[model samples]
Target: MLLLLLGYDAINWFDGRFSLPTPGMLAAPCEFIDVVVTERAAVTGDQSAVAITFAAPDGSPLPAWSAGAHIDVTLPSGTVRQYSLCGDPTDQSSYRIAVRLIQDGRGGSAEVHSALTVGTEFQVARPRNAFPLAVGGYNQTTSAVRLIAGGIGVTPILPMLDMLDRTATPWSMIYCGRTRDSLAFLSELARFGDRVTIHEDATYGPASAEELLGDLTVSSAVYTCGPPPMIDALRAALVDRPDVEFHYERFSLAPVVDGREFDLRFASSGEVVRVAADQTALSAILGARPDATYSCQQGFCRSCAVRVLDGAPEHRSTALSPGELDAGYFLPCVSRSEGCLTIDM
Candidate 1:
């Protein structure tokens, strides 16, 4: 993604997308709510994915959400995990999200797959739409919106497809995965017919990110969710395609690049936490302060922003406003300091 710079004082858009917020953006709260698992099903034949539905115990309307919203689910083991709401946004009776068992990931997914069941009660933060779909005005340069998904990334795009269809908007999607068995919701995509394209790496090589770079192809507005390599390739290919309005949500936190070890000192407690080169300041501080609040491990959500007492922090998250940065705020999730940072905690 391209990074943009304003004047010397303003801290340019830090998402690296370097773009303005599109239509239908809404501020979301991080408040938690009580809910129970009303239904569960395996979307993938290989048992890799489990589609779970949650609703209020009394069946009251849940919080309203947009197409690309996600909720932070607190599992039985007290592990918090974020999952995109794939079900209809218009439905207030319940919210649906899917989880693909990630053996190599943190233990959250494993506990979800093993312990989450019908009638399971848990707390989930109200839906937060970090990837809101562009609704009202379509980009004039591009005629339609292109939806792209990779592997389990389809979770967010599913509600997008429904929203486009309901509004009678022109759009298409390309779903890529390692194989057919690994891709979730094939039967769901079948409803869209030829508008949806499936590329499995088992047969054809991985989908090329360059395919959408052509002027005649890929709508002017493109939204994609996928693993990093695919997302990175698309961003690199679109670097020169300035006419295209591109937005993406990554499946995981970005690895700290050119990272160096730093010490984080707490101003209130007078304690210190050593952040390794590969570790985020948020992760390192969480070990010492388990009560610290955070939602998206990615930097875009400002749930992890802290006030910097001292030191030069390399701000990497877009969530903090230029004014916030000027006020000595820092996002430890993605930002790193040159040497040591004293924070308010």
Candidate 2:
């Protein structure tokens, strides 16, 4: 059966054939693919939108993806950033990503916003997902779904709302931005009637995290995506409620200089790196061995993740939930060694 499957995949690749994965194959993992940006446009004041078109080597559709899956785009400056697919997953023609230029960022968004143009080629890892929509339970019977987005965090939620509308699922969205003019998809979100709420910090007082989520019940599931300050605030405000499923995405890395010095021991390589108060474990590793691989040094990508064999990791990545952190996985890119730590590397 394994030989048959391998032969079939080979034939499909060469013949330009594509289909959904079988149940057995689905249980196995999928490989990443390369995609190219065929078109680009400036969508908002500081956001530029790009449409990436991918195909099999023989011009067939690539594997289908789910709604929340995101692809990592290797920018012109070699910085890899993950952007959620805003296009319909059912559509195989192309995938679209909207990037907001960050004035003070480490240059990934700026390079994408300024340099990338039509016909630019870049490699994309296959869609990997950490935030998938809840299917049954409260997600199914709930009369309404509330989506909270902060700034550029709206990209992933856009397609989710479309999918809900297509299924005639009742949902509402609250988009928070610094100002009315800075919000992306403002006009489109407004068309959803009172179901869509826009909060501008410049005009209305900043959206109160406690006030906004205070009334959440077991019947409702809340999805949030934004920077650390907002997510941290919301998490703290809603810490008492374990009944409500809170899903969120963060784009920022953990602070490296906040914690005290800690020792890190790599089991596989028998290497010990002391994480200084001013340096992260990843930085220490890369400083000693410059060939270490990493992307999105923000901890959003799992590229720099190492298995924690023992001791606690001061996990600071928004990529992993509390459950995953408890399971002993650590993203060394942004996470610091809380104390003496041993990792499988």
Pick the lDDT winner: 1
Q: How many backbone clashes does candidate 2 have?
A: 1
lDDT of 2 by residue, 1-345 (tens): 000000000000010111232221111122556666666766555454333344433445756777666766666565556677767788876777777766666666767767666666666567766666654435365544668887777877777877777764467778888887678776667677887788888988878886455466455567777776777787776666655556776655434557789988777677888988877787876666555555556555555656688888887776665765666777776788658888765
List all candidate RMSDs to the true structure.
Answer: 7.4, 10.5
* Native-referenced Cα lDDT, model 2: 0.63
Report model 1's TM-score to 2 decimal places: 0.82
lDDT of 1 at 280: 89
Candidate 1, 1-345: lDDT as tens digits: 122111011110011111121121213245778899999999987889999998998888999999888877877766667788999899999999888887876577777778889999998888877787875555433467788888888988899998888665578888988889999999999999998888888999876876533333444567888787877888777777665677787776567788899999988788999999999898897888766655566665566667888899998777777887888887777889878999886
Model 2: colliding residue pairs: 32-126
Badly placed stretches (over 4 Å) of model 1 are 1-29, 138-142, 211-219, 257-261, 266-279, 284-293, 300-303, 318-329
- TM-score for candidate 2: 0.72
Please give me the total number of clashing residue pairs in predicted model 1: 0
Q: List per-prediction Cα lDDT, in the order shown.
A: 0.75, 0.63
